[model samples]
Target: MRSFFRWLRPYGLVVYWVMLLGLMYLETVNNLPIPTDAEGAAFAQNFENDLSRNVFASLIEITCLYLILRPWSFTQSIGRVVGALVLVLLWTSGLFYVAFNADRISNVLGIHLLWLVVLNLGLVVILIWRVGRLLWRSLQQSRQR
Candidate 1:
């Protein structure tokens, strides 16, 4: 875990932010249909119909969050911090879009509320386990000293 942090620390936060934003932008642009005179509003409606893509986009956002937050230490450089803030704006915007359109996505997916509840609960459990593991390792190291 220490080695993981050490390896990522040098890679710089800017790289992570760029990758997140770039992938998100690519996904959004690629999936969204261009509104033509004939197609008009229907183009957008078509894009909204794909629940799988919506879920995929949300997963991308989650991955981005994981990458950005993985390092316990955010950044050593002020420049990187500023860059991350900018990237965060893009990330938040994407999240907001997803949140607002969640109903539509759920409708398209034909998923029940219980499933969403279960998924969130599962995530919580995973997070708790990871934190516990980290804390246990830290305690073990301290005891060795």
Candidate 2:
């Protein structure tokens, strides 16, 4: 178990957390401040139905995973691959439920929508930190080479 964690990069974990936080921010924005006017409500519903928040969230997850994981080489083990696939599927399912069934979820769970933009802005901070670390390490490796 320790070895498994050692194989993962710190930046990868950071990016994953950023992605999850970003998704939470998106959901919070989508649910908060129930639309009062007909035009605004219609726009919100249309945006949900036409854009498919699940698709956007999935794209962000995939892109972040690729960026964060591509630098490292992993052992081509079947178990690891299968596990990754299962995780991806499960994440997609959860995103779908959250995107489409948020009303029902909030009603049942009594969760309040607190859409603070600062939380979303935090992703930018994470990205900047990760990118700076990546560049510094790359430079160090090149100097050694």
Candidate 3:
């Protein structure tokens, strides 16, 4: 276990960025409306159904990109963790929104929205664990040094 974690330490940022990209892709792709119906008109109408989901999806992608590229000062690192946690909470809330408003999400877009919620939840758990482990290891290394 120690050896695995040690190996991960050097590549922690890389792993995090990869996971972030994956989450972004999942959220963006799943939120997009894919047409399965014979009527091409329905597909066109789907995009107009609701802009909220797409807006939030874009926000998430932008935030993820900022998290990956922005140089973090000590305080900023803490803020980033907190911000990530908040985003996860918001995504979970979206799940509840979908649950209560099932009628609003009965179409293809709705299914994709659910997928995005589930995927984001899993990514959140992985990210929290990874960040916790990295912080613990960093503290340990500092003590040893």
Q: Give the top-scoring candidate (lDDT).
A: 3
Per-model TM-score on C-alpha atoms: 0.30, 0.30, 0.40
lDDT of 1 at 37: 57
TM-score winner among the candidates?
3
Q: Which scores better on lDDT, 2 or 3?
A: 3
Error of 1 at 57 (Å): 17
Query: Model 2, 105: alpha-carbon shift in Å?
Result: 8.9
Candidate 3 wrong stretches, greater than 4 Å:
1-78, 102-104, 142-145
For 12-90, candidate 2 gives per-residue lDDT tens digits of: 4445545555655465566555444654532233233323443454456556544533535643323433444455545
Residue 64 lDDT (model 2): 51
User: What is the C-alpha lDDT profile of model 1 across 1-145, one tens digit per residue?
Assistant: 9987577654534464455445544555555554445635332332443545645654564456456455455433334333444555555555546656763333322222223333345445545656677689889999999
Model 2 alpha-carbon miss at residue 35, Å: 5.2
What's the best-to-worst order under lDDT?
3, 1, 2
The 10 consecutive residues of candidate 3 with the worst lDDT sum are 68-77
* Model 3: pairs clashing at backbone N, Cα or C within 3 Å: none
How well does model 2 score by local distance difference test? 0.45
